[model samples]
Target: MTREASPAQRTRALIIDAAADLLAASASGEFSTREVCDAAGVTAPTLYHHFGDKDGLLREVAADRFSRYLTRKQALETTGDPVEDFRRGWDMHVEFGVANPALYNIMYGRRIEGRTTPADHAHAVLVTMMRDLERAGRLRMPTGTAADMVASAAVGVTLHLIRTRAAADDHLSALVRDAVTAAVISPPTVPGAASVTPQLARAAAQLEAEMPHGSVGTLRASEATLLREWLTQLSVLGRMAGGAPS
Candidate 1:
């Protein structure tokens, strides 16, 4: 059986839920602390006691709502193929962004320094997926670089869709996803004559990914750290050689 929340927990939850409702209903996708307090049937002091400030309240609300969204996202089963999983992940991200514009904006649109959100979990999932692709010899770039490219493009397209309130057919999320995949994933090569550069990049990326699994072979922790740093540089060398930033 589920345990009941304490009175304090209950009150905090009430405040967060009220703020989320206000944020969702507001034209600007924001709400004042006074508004949230009033909506929650609490005074400013009570709200501040629980959340410290308006920003804290909003951050909590965003984290709560994003966590719920992630719960649903995590429910989707993986298909074993990393590429297909990434396609589904991209689709889910765009769909969630479009469906929950206010929350999406709060979760991803705001840029704050030194503050992490529940959204970081989503990015972590992407990085792990990229690592899987690297291990499979299908990645064409460093895992971090590929994650950045895919995330930037996906978020940019989703934000455009949100701003324009584009119709289903007009949304170019799939096209953008496909373009990113083509740019970062190696196409299946024939039996012979595969390019060496992508092979090198993939090997470097795979090694970097494996480093986190702990000391490789007989390497000490310090040695593994240095090796990872070198692999990171090597992973991006091919792109640098081709005039892209390392």
Candidate 2:
């Protein structure tokens, strides 16, 4: 058998795992340096040497996890129908929220914790999607502010899914999709405009390949599948609302 690692390597491994747990357990409060040291069974000097400082370590973890999440989100396909995309997007929101509850809470309400870093990439993606829908003439509103509403509602729906933890039924995704559909003001599609596009599968395939390294790739595959199933269920929402793929 191979020899065991040295003490230094062991310490680093311990810190990383502890940090992950701490991150998962993290709420709207800041974890003091002393608290981290106590939790990790390491000294402050060791943490400082390994990660510079507490804030530095937290930032590092945030950057890493945020990158991973966006990388996964970027891999999602629009499925050719703007309405369907929104439905799928809502599902993605909930799954992402449920899968990474800690990160979701952090990003959603970091201000409460006084961690006020602007997640530029995330805002950019939201803006891009909103603008794209507007260009497609999807918003029923006279103005182009519907995207903001959609983003807010999406986040709300995500929080609802996280907080409401209904019975462990198989159709929870369906429930979320329908609920989200009822919430959004959908696009107007002249008859037959909502048909499936040939570009969808290809686009989805391209998205999956973007995050090949780390567990991000496998995780995204699950997210995509969950999103698709959610879309199918939310079709009821589409019929009830004035949109496609509801």
Candidate 3:
């Protein structure tokens, strides 16, 4: 059964919707609190009560709208192959930016100190995918590093596409995606010629992923902490060695 939103929830939604409408119609991507309050049919104090201030209100509006894109990303069905799933994620990111230029600009362009954004949630999802690759011995660097590389490159490509209005240039996105992917992911290992550095890194990553789950067996807390330090060092060495083909 579906439950109706409470009155406060409805009011908050009203303010957010009003702000989004104004932002979309805005030429400078800026809207005054007065404008939002008028559009929402709420008093200034009421607006402040709900969202702290103007920046807070804008952040909420961007997060609320960007959540739709994040929903689709979270709902994406993964293939057995993590690399293919990663590629699909990249494509979806670009498509979302191209389809919603105004929302995309505000979502990615603005930065608020000490505040988390929907984009951070998306990066978390990417990090999880990179972990899958690490477990499969396909990742060449630490999972966080690989995820950061992919996120940075994907955003750059998406923004370029949005700024130039070159949504038709699909090849450019694919090229950048593949380039970043190749840099961070290792080729499949042959029968007996597996690269030692990647193998060590993969083993370390798998252990690191499992450690937090109390999967370290009989190791004491102190012992586990020391082991994690060692694993981190190995992972760094693997990254420094680069992603040579196996």
Candidate 4:
């Protein structure tokens, strides 16, 4: 069985669609509430009643579009290698930004306080990928630190491409991606590897990922907690001292 949208929902969708069309056609990425009301054929009070304010309307617009972008990313097939998947994710992010300059700016360029944006959801996906790399002994830094580095660099590169209109510069995106990837990923470990520090760091990371949250076997819950902290510290220290090159 199919359920139809209420009149209110249809009106809200109409407004959002109108705003999105205007935003895409806008050169400066700026629009007035009056313009939106005109485009949607809605009264000012009706617009305000639905969205509260212009900023609220804009936030909803950005969230709606960015959520669609995330849906495509989520549907992508993983390449088994988390590193490769991460590279693909980075490229996709830049592609999305270049393709939707106005919407991308709204999504990432400004802060929308007291709300969860799709950008935050995208970062969480990156963090989860970093953790996967950590568990595989491929990551060199703390998962959170690595995620932050990649997210910051990717966003910066995307914004630069958007502003400079150099969206076709694949070399520029690749150069930055490779640089950041090299900084955070370790070379594949060989059996009986000679580098002790990297090996130790990988061991610590793997153990940390596998560590039980509560008591297991002879270990108490408190002991497991303490051991997890120590492993994390060891991993961080080892990476700080320099791990294998990517």
Clashes of each: 0, 2, 0, 0
- Model 3: runs farther than 4 Å from truth? 189-246
lDDT of 1 by residue, 175-207 (tens): 778767666676443344322376687777787
TM-scores of all predicted structures: 0.73, 0.53, 0.73, 0.75
Pairs that collide in candidate 4 are: none
- Residue-level lDDT of model 2, residues 1-246, one tens digit each, is 989999987886677657756778776435677777787899989988977876566655565677776678769765887777766666666676776666666667553222344344565676777677657755434333655665666566666666775322226566545544433444354454344433443444344345334454444544644544444334423443444421
Q: Residues 1-246, candidate 4, lDDT per residue (tens digit)?
A: 879999999999899999999999999999898999999999999999988988888888988888888888889888887668777888888999999899889889987764777789888888988898898887867999999999999999999999899863568899888777766776554444343388788888888777644345698555665566566656665656677312
| Superior by lDDT: candidate 2 or candidate 3 | 3
Candidate 4: where are CA atoms >4 Å away? 191-246
Q: After the best TM-score superposition of candidate 1, give how far the Cα of residue 205 lies from its true spot, in angstroms.
A: 18
lDDT of 3 by residue, 1-246 (tens): 889999999999999999999878876677799999899999999999999988788778878988877887778677877668778878988998887777777778777644787788778878988898999888868998998999899889988997887873478998888767666776654443433478878788777767768657787655666677666556655665674223
Q: Best candidate per lDDT, number?
A: 4
Per TM-score, what order, best first? 4, 1, 3, 2
Weakest 10 consecutive residues of candidate 1 by summed lDDT: 187-196
Error of 3 at 102 (Å): 3.1
TM-score of 4: 0.75
lDDT score, candidate 4: 0.81
